[model samples]
Target: MNETIQTILNRRSIRAYESRQIDEHELQEILLAGEYAPTAMGQQPWHFTVLQNPDLIEKLQTLCKASFLNSDNASLREIATREDFQVFYNAPTLVIISGNSKAIAPLQDCVLSMANMLLAATSLGIGSCWVHSPMMVYGSADGAASLSNIGIDFPKGYEPYAAAVFGYSAQPLPKAGPRNSDTVTMIR
Candidate 1:
């Protein structure tokens, strides 16, 4: 199989990470990969906010958990209060992908960029996980204030669509699960 194909096949969402941070060059490469992702109508309406400060990461996780607990969703509140939960999985870096609120297919564009970043991280032997709780938290007023404090700014109408954590794996990741072929359809 081709190298790119192999990378895609082997990619996994890593939850446990070492305390060490990824190299600056590797992080740059991953960001560049996201920047090069194809967008609808060539409109790259996404902003990637990379946070490497451990203090900020901890603060964000705390804010996110608190926001989750305040939500009306009972399940989310329960999960947020769990002892084992860390929104960013203790990774040394967090990348928040936000999109222009008025752009066509902004969410899709952000997702494509995140996918590219994930693949790039995999190819570089870096562990990464897609995080959705930040998106949930950022939608709230207090979360917006926290983001502003952390220097994550969005244009008046922009919003966070996705987030990810990156670092070196602390343990070997589990194997990929069996594919569900039934989810696909063919017309040919």
Candidate 2:
């Protein structure tokens, strides 16, 4: 298989990460890849917020945990109760993608951008996991205030759609699980 295909197959949602941050050059490449993702009507109505400060990441994690604890979803509450739980898996870098609310398909555009970034990170031998807690937390009024207090200011009319963490893996990559055979159908 070609390198791109190999990279896609090898990519996994990494949950544990080393303390060291990813290289700046590699991060730039990943963000560039995100920028190139397909957008609705070429609006490219998305904003990338990269958070590398450890203090800020810790604060965001705390906020996410608190939000999760208050969630009605038992799964979220259970996860939040874990003593070792870290919303971003303790990754050194977090990237939040926000989309213009007026765009044709803001959520889809932002999600595609995130997918590109994840693939790019995997190609660079970096681990990445799409963490949804940020979006969940940021959607609430309290969470919005907390995010603002921490200096995360999205462009006016833009709302966060996706968030992910990137870093070097602390453990060996796990083997891919078996694929579900009935999920796709060929129209031709």
Candidate 3:
């Protein structure tokens, strides 16, 4: 298989990471990949928030944990109750993708962007995990307000649709899980 296909197959959702931050140049390349993702009507109505500060990342994690604890989902509450739970898995960098509310397909556009970023990160030997808890926390009005109070502000009319953490993997790359062959259908 070609390199792109190989990378796609090799990419996995990393859950553990090292303390060192990824290089600036590599991060820019990943962000560029996200920027190039296909957008609906070429609107490209997406904003990327890169959080590298340790304090801010911790604060956001705390907020997300609180949200989970208060959630009605028992699984979420159980996870939040763990004392060592870190929402971003202690990755040195967190990227939050947001989309303009007026865009034709904001959520889809943002998700595509996230997928590009994840692939890019994997290609660069960086570990990445798609984090959904942040969206769970920041999707609400109160959560947005709390984020604003902490100086993490999104562009006006833009709402977070996806988030992920990137860093050097502390553990060995995991093997790909077995795939089910029955999921696909032939249309032609």
Which candidate should be chosen as best, given TM-score against the real structure?
3
| Count: clashes, candidate 2 | 0
lDDT of 1 at 106: 91
Candidate 1 local lDDT, residue 22: 99
Model 2 ranges off by over 4 Å: none
Per-residue lDDT of 1-188 in model 1, one digit per residue for the tens? Answer: 99999999989999999999899999999999999999989999988889898988887888888888889999989998899978788999999889998999999999999999999999999999999988878878677888788666777778999899999998797799999878978899
Look at candidate 2 and give me any clashing residue pairs: none
Put down candidate 3 lDDT per residue, 1-188, tens digits, no spaces: 99999999999999999999999999999999999999999999999999999999999988998899889899999999998888899999999998998999999999999999999999999999999987898865499998987778999999999999999998888888899889989899
> Better model by lDDT, 1 or 2?
2
Q: Candidate 2: deviation at residue 175, Å?
A: 1.5
Write down the lDDT that model 2 would get.
Answer: 0.93
Error of 3 at 121 (Å): 0.7
Measured against the true structure, the TM-scores of the candidates, in listed sequence, are 0.93, 0.97, 0.97
Error of 3 at 29 (Å): 0.3
